[model samples]
Target chain A: MGNVAYAVLSSDEQEVSIMEKKIQWETELVHALQRSKVEKRPILLDFHNPH
Target chain B: MDTVTYPQQSVVTFIEHNLIPLRVGSDTQPLASDFAVTWTPTLVLLDPQGKEHHRTVGFFDAEALIPSLLLGLGKVEYDSNKFKEALGYLEKLLAEYPESDSAPEAIFLTGVNRYKSTGNPLPLKEAYEQLQRMYPASTWTKRAYPYRLLG
Candidate 1:
């Protein structure tokens, strides 16, 4: 059931819930693909210009 | 996208439910050079092996984004030869977001997915007809022009 990996943004339980409600973005492509394979889900890779 | 699209509740939920979201700076490392990042907000869908199935360069609002991602997921399944699974995603996109920018392409792929799964060319012809009737000016309609002769 717990197949998807969540990126923990905060340690607080309340903050964790709030974070979970948002898109959990993984920073590393390698890590993202690893989770993707395990979950059998595709990866939505967004390359944004931070400027 | 950060300021507008991604923050939308529907977009967040859709993405969280179906995809592994990865965010990276365009200028970030080997990936930038590998994927050829010459622009901002380039969204690419990759299989777990890092094979790209679909890509959209530039911006897409929440309405457009959902269908595009659905098409990508369908493409991923199509590429993997999972025709039934591909149809599931493509059909959902067409049924839910038929007026979206991604709809024409979804229709085109839905036809192809149907043909591949059933070994029937009739679906391809029907796809062309549907595209002609629904989106006569779409590029997908043009792309499926040859499919019109499939019957």
Candidate 2:
């Protein structure tokens, strides 16, 4: 039982680590544009299909 | 892009450090029309004032994407009259990823920036020769055809 529990915890930790590597995309274009202007950074607009 | 490209460490770090990344649906309003994005998964890089400097359609892997983004950043600087800064980015792309999809464009633009800054046609001539030698069949080589007449 302890061994099974350890395996589950390891799996969960691996899942979390994978999730953490994904990019956190900003959803609001207006806000992103404003922030980019303020931050003096270029805006990378990604037009993607939700479907 | 999310599952394959964006998850790469180098791509994520580059975007985070140099760009304000925004993801929107293709159907998103005036912004989509403003950029004339007719295709899904189109990536457009805009200057701070919302002027577009570069765009690419379709999906790209991390290796292809980085050089493209770097070229866009170089164009942004070039459009802003920062020729020296633009050359720095373009030269770096050429040095590191000479075979990248964006490399031909970077090489072409390096010549343009050099000519613009130094008022010498030699760089343009060299660019034309390089493009002809390295990417004979590429459209970039065709675009540099006019430079051949400069001699």
Backbone clashes, candidate 2:
0
lDDT of 1 at A10: 52
Which runs in model 2 stand beyond 4 Å of their true positions?
Answer: A1-20, B149-151
Put down candidate 1 lDDT per residue, B1-151, tens digits, no spaces. 8878988889999999999999999999899999988998899999999999999998999999999999999999999999999999999999999999999999999899899889999999999999999999999999999998887
After superposition, which runs of candidate 1 have C-alpha atoms over 4 Å from their true positions?
Answer: A1-20
Pairs of colliding residues, candidate 2? none
Q: Which digits, one per residue and each the tens of the lDDT, describe model 2 over residues B1-151? A: 8788998888989898889999999988887888887997999998877888999999999999999999999999999999999998899899988999899999899999999999999899889899999999889899998998775
Q: Report the TM-score of candidate 2, chain B only.
A: 0.95
In terms of docking quality, model 1 is medium
Candidate RMSDs in Å, in order, are: 8.0, 3.2
How well does each candidate superpose onto the true structure, as a TM-score? 0.89, 0.89
Clashes of each: 0, 0
